[model samples]
Target: GTYPLYDITASPLTSGTHKFDGPEKNNPYRVLGIDEKQNYARFRFSGERNKRKLNVEFLGIKGEKLGEWSISENDLKTPKQ
Candidate 1:
């Protein structure tokens, strides 16, 4: 499954509210919303924000990492909504 992209280059993936989005368009992934409070953030391509580095852990619903991806948040160029 797709996961949110966070700038984990600063720190490891942790369970907390954080910002996740595209690093730049044409990347390959995206994170939506900045008003994060849950453990994991939601992201997608669908034209949202700039492309971002997603070399982070993909946290699951239980705050557990499902896997990891080294893609950008610019896979799409439009909102899914």
Candidate 2:
């Protein structure tokens, strides 16, 4: 499956909420806000039928990699109520 590549670090991100445009035009999943003080970030994913896993990387202020992880499709699925 082909996934759209996003250049998230095109501009310096501050320590607060933010909203930006995605790689695809008119994309709804466009929020990629990261709050350093709160140690959390928010982003939405557009479901891909053939995607089995997603890889995420965390970077510091100086562009150093803090950590990395992979999310399996199973873990991304909503649990049954």
Candidate 3:
């Protein structure tokens, strides 16, 4: 919830603006689907537990890989998959 991770402009207590305005565009270091066996539902977004840069992959209803993504904290688009 800080800069570098959230690419948004901070609004100072001037110009009548009182808070930061803009959509949050940063992916939080994800956790899950991390290692093989998945052990907790392969390809499924079991959960975002760990706080570290890690890779993730989405799955379809039938358990098919849909796409891949890398979750990290930086001034980047939080890929809305």
Model 2: weakest 10-residue lDDT segment is: 35-44
- Residue-wise C-alpha lDDT for candidate 2, range 14-68, written one tens digit per residue: 5563443454435565443433422322233545775666566556566665555
In candidate 3, stretches whose alpha carbon ends up further than 4 angstroms from where it belongs are 1-51, 73-81
Residue-by-residue lDDT tens digits, candidate 3, 1-81: 223352222222222422222432222532222222111122223334443454555444455664565545432444554
For residues 3-78, what per-residue lDDT tens digits would candidate 1 score against the true structure?
Answer: 4434432223354656555554334533422224343433433333575544545554567655454555555234
TM-score of each: 0.22, 0.35, 0.27
Sort the candidates on lDDT, descending order.
2, 1, 3
Q: Is candidate 1 or candidate 3 better by TM-score?
A: 3
- Of 1 and 3, which scores higher on lDDT? 1
Please report, in order, the local distance difference test score of every candidate based on alpha carbons. 0.45, 0.48, 0.35
lDDT of 2: 0.48
Q: What is the lDDT of residue 25 in candidate 1?
A: 33
Of the candidates shown, which would achieve the greatest lDDT relative to the real structure? 2
lDDT of 1: 0.45
